[model samples]
Target: MRIVIALGGNAMTAPDGGARVEDQLAAIGAAAEPIADLVLAGHEVLLTHGNGPQVGNLLRKNELAATVVPPIPLDWCDASTQATIGVTILDALDDALGARGSDRRTTVLVSRTLVDRDDPGFAHPTKPIGRYLTRDEAEPLIDHGQEFVEIAGRGWRRVVASPEPRECLDAAAADTLLAAGYVVVCSGGGGIPTQRTADGRLEGVEAVIDKDLTAALVAGHIGADLLVIATDVATVIRGYQTPTQQPIGTLTAPAMRELAAREAFAAGSMGPKVEAITRFAERGGIGVITSLDRITDAVTGTAGTRVVPAG
Candidate 1:
């Protein structure tokens, strides 16, 4: 089966603030175990990941490097973060495959996704970016025309417009890699949202694309039979966190629409997952949503919310 798996960011960070590279290597190594099993089991896999924490860490590095060189834009920082993660993950997968006595090849493509220049999301700028800063620290950036919004009432963060993605800029390349029997990891952090200039040159935009939405696009582009979204939760819950919350095992597209209308999922959380699954199912795609540990089972259809089209 051709599958696209979107790994979440929390998988990389521990409870405390430490983010040593070796520790992250160990964490991702644990996460990639089931994935390697899938590869060994003969499923064609394309991996994508979220870089929220990674990019934030890179932004701090940029700030520190300002004394030696000028800090780069957030979009460029995201691109660098993607390369860092893709390289690290590819190395781990290579090591894991070798340790398992398999000779499967894994590759990371520094992917780029195309976004509509006129997307309404550009006007809203809802996706947060950069390092979290104290009010005093954020005030200067705000004064200098950088966008900052208060999150959780503790501090401020940069909010970038998370526009809808139109296409994976490197979809053809990813497909080629997949066809060549390589486990390709592409489209990290929604591929560094980009647009075409009037002269037809692609340029980076100062925003993000919803990673789940991007994953759906990648799945469809690759003709994937399954798109498994690995999150912190084991299953998507309706009326989440409420007294009457219920876990959903399966849902028809229409039923999902009704729940979505009632706002069952939080906007910054599970809402996008539902929307992404809906889009994938509506487009003749199959999908599962589950915790990271349950990923292999989710792919085998024994676990997770198996979202299918409404009959």
Candidate 2:
């Protein structure tokens, strides 16, 4: 089957959110094992990952050196983190495949995703990024037009607009690579949010796009049979964090949409994931939500929350 797997940023970072290069590579190396297994099992795979921690680290560096040099824009930061994480994934997957005695090739395409300039997301920036800061430290940034929201007792965090992705501009390239039997990695950090100018030139926007939503877009564009969204959880829970919490198994697209309409999932966490999978399922593709370790099982229908088209 043609598969598109979206790895969460937490898969590439330490639990405490350390951004050291070696540690991040080690984390990705571990995550690459299951992916390599899928490739060896004869499934064509396309990989994409989140960049929350990495991009946040870059933004922190920019702030530290703002007086010494100009800070990089958010779009550039997205591009930068995509390359950084892409190369690391390429290296790790290469090693994993080699260890399994497969000579399969892997490649990365720094992609662009189109978004509307007038997206309501731009007017309401809700996606949080960067490390938590004390109110005293956040005041200056707030004065400079940056938005911050206090996370209960966790302190303040910078937020950015998470615009919806309209298209993955490099989906053709990814399709070509997949046809050639290459494990393709593209659309990291939601493909560096882009828009068209009045003169028809492509320009990067100062916003982030949700990776799961972009993954669904890319899956449809490339005609993927299966979309796997790998998160830290093994399965989607029906009543998360409560005594009645239970793991969801197989759900029809319409059933999932009904649950979504009722706000059964947390907005910041499982909501986007369930929405993405439902979108894919509505388009006649199977979607799985599971942790990285259970990817093969999820594909085989023995594990994970599987979303299928309603009859």
Candidate 3:
């Protein structure tokens, strides 16, 4: 089976913050065990990772250097992160796969996801990014007309648009790698958002695409049999952390969507993931949302929320 796994940003970076390179190495290296296991187990594997923390760090550097140098655009920051994080994943996979004595080769393809130039997302920059600041610091940012929001106990950060990804420019790359038996790693930060001109040329845009949604698009384009979203949780829990909390198991796409309509998942957190998987499930592909530790088990049907057809 061909499997496309989307590793969440927090899953690959230091959960504590700072986007430290050493910690990223450690975290990504830990992920290699499961990725290699899948390859060793004779399944074609492709990888896509998130870079929320890393990009936020880069944006900070861009802001500090604005006076000395031209400010970097959002698309360029996304590109910068894709290269940095792509190298890390490739390096970690190489070390781990080599230790296991497998001859599988790995490669990274910088993906460009297509988004509508007139997407409603551009009208509303609702997705937050970058470092958090205290109210005093945040209030000062408003002088420059930057949008800030106070998220729970966390301080305020700049928000940006999150547009829907209409297509993946490198969808064919995955198929080519799968046919050649290579473990392909691509699509960092939901890929560098791009748009087409009237003359049919591609150019970068100033927005980010939802990583989970982009992963689903790539999985569909590559004709993956399974889409495994390796998130921070073991399973989908309804009413989480309360008296009536419940673990979600096998269910059809429609059933899951119904739960979503009733607000079972938090929009900023688990909502995108569930919606992405539900779409994949409805398209006749198996979807699993589980921790990276249980990825192999999830494939074997022993763990995670296995989304299937109701009939």
At residue 148, candidate 2 shows an lDDT of: 85
Q: lDDT per model, in order?
A: 0.83, 0.90, 0.85
lDDT per residue (tens digit) for residues 1-311 in model 1? 99999988756655353567866777788778889989998999999998877777777775556446555776787789788888888888898889899998888888788988888988878777767788776665565566888888668987878888899989999999999999998999888888998889999988877889999999999899999999888988877777998888888777778878996677788888888888898888777889989998998788888788778
Candidate 2 TM-score, C-alpha based:
0.93
Give the winner by TM-score: 2
Error of model 2, residue 117, in angstroms? 1.1
Tell me the tens digit of each residue's lDDT in model 3 across 1-311.
Answer: 99989998656777675468888888898988888888899999989988888887777775566446555777888888888888888888888889999778888888899998788988888887777877776664555456778888988888878999889899897789889988898787899999998888999977878899999899899999999999888998988898998888988999988987886688777988998889898888989899999999988888998787567
Total clashing pairs for each candidate:
0, 0, 0
Best of the two (2, 3) by TM-score: 2
What is the overall TM-score of model 3 with all chains considered together? Answer: 0.92
How far is 50's C-alpha from truth in model 3 (Å)? 0.7
Write the residue-wise lDDT of candidate 2 on 35-67 in tens digits: 999999999999998998888888788656655
lDDT of 3 at 203: 96
Error of 2 at 186 (Å): 0.6
- Model 1 alpha-carbon drift over 4 Å, by segment: 15-18, 64-68, 131-136, 139-145, 149-156
> Candidate 3 at 93: error in angstroms?
1.0
